[model samples]
Target: MSESSDRLQRRSAPKRLTADDWADAALAALAERGLAAVAVEPLAARLGTTKGSFYWHFANRDALVAAALARWEEVSTERIIRAMETAEPDPAARLGALLRGATLSVVDDPLEVRLLAAGDHPEVAAALARVTERRIGYLAHLFELLGFPAPEARHRGFFAYTSYLGHAQVAHAVPGAVPTDPAYLAAVTAALLKR
Candidate 1:
């Protein structure tokens, strides 16, 4: 083939951005700037593409939003739970790791904070409910394994989840209000796990 023809072919073949690519970009926009910023044009520009590419993958903005929320639920909640269950055998140690990780990574990971802010939307609310239930249930199971009665286990799980939510709010809304130092995090985790 001629050099010019080859160049033309390459230029005409726009990058093939997959549906997952668009979905992930939408989630990032949602996390960084909230649900309003997940619009196609904005995400297309962010991905260095055009609306045509977005439409090629998603049917509409609502579809894209649904995909983004599903991705968030899978990545943020399900994956973490799976990893915790597989990687740690001891309930106490798994709980400690979870509590410490959640506390320490608050500022660095604000997707949950962003989602909570947008929870009024139907899709966001549904996803939030599912994740909250799953997380709290898992925490409760861990507490149960640690020998707490069912009711106490459930309450502790709720408390731990709420504590993380509060800590995340402080860390995200007012930096430096919550100390994420190693010692501080360890102390907090120990306190949570204390019988």
Candidate 2:
């Protein structure tokens, strides 16, 4: 092979980028340039790799989007579900605790907030809706554990999900917002939950 051909082949050989690494690079690209900038070509370039690597790991753009949504769910919705599951289990206190834990967890995690805030893409929105529904169902189950009637528990669960997401939306839109204050959020959530 010619010298140029050899160099090109060596450079194009797959580099090791884990799912987490690709996600991280994609998140950074999302933050630095916004959602439109997160196309696979740019993401691949950002990872010091190529589009072939992305397809090798994911089925298509839809699949990659699902991965991003899954990661967001892991950090955001899953945290809430896990917190509710492990906390005191009194519906009110558990709800408060989940919000508190999630609020604390959000400190400086802008990418997490941004991804959660993205309800624009139809696929992302669908994935998030599924995650949110599961979370609400879990919350309803938690309420049933606390003596709430079946229907009431279901309504409350949906309400809680909406409230938390609403807060996330507000947090994402408010420039210079920080999750440094626990007492305020806890107090706010506690008051809000009791209503």
lDDT tens digits by residue: candidate 1, 75-134: 888888999989999898899899888788777878889999999999999999998999
TM-score of 1: 0.90
> By summed lDDT, which 10 consecutive residues of candidate 1 come out lowest?
184-193
Clashes of each: 0, 0
Q: How close is every model to the real structure, measured as TM-score?
A: 0.90, 0.69
Clashing pairs in 2: none
Candidate 1 residue runs with Cα over 4 Å from true position: 1-15
How high is the CA lDDT of each candidate model?
Answer: 0.89, 0.69
lDDT for 94 (candidate 2): 78
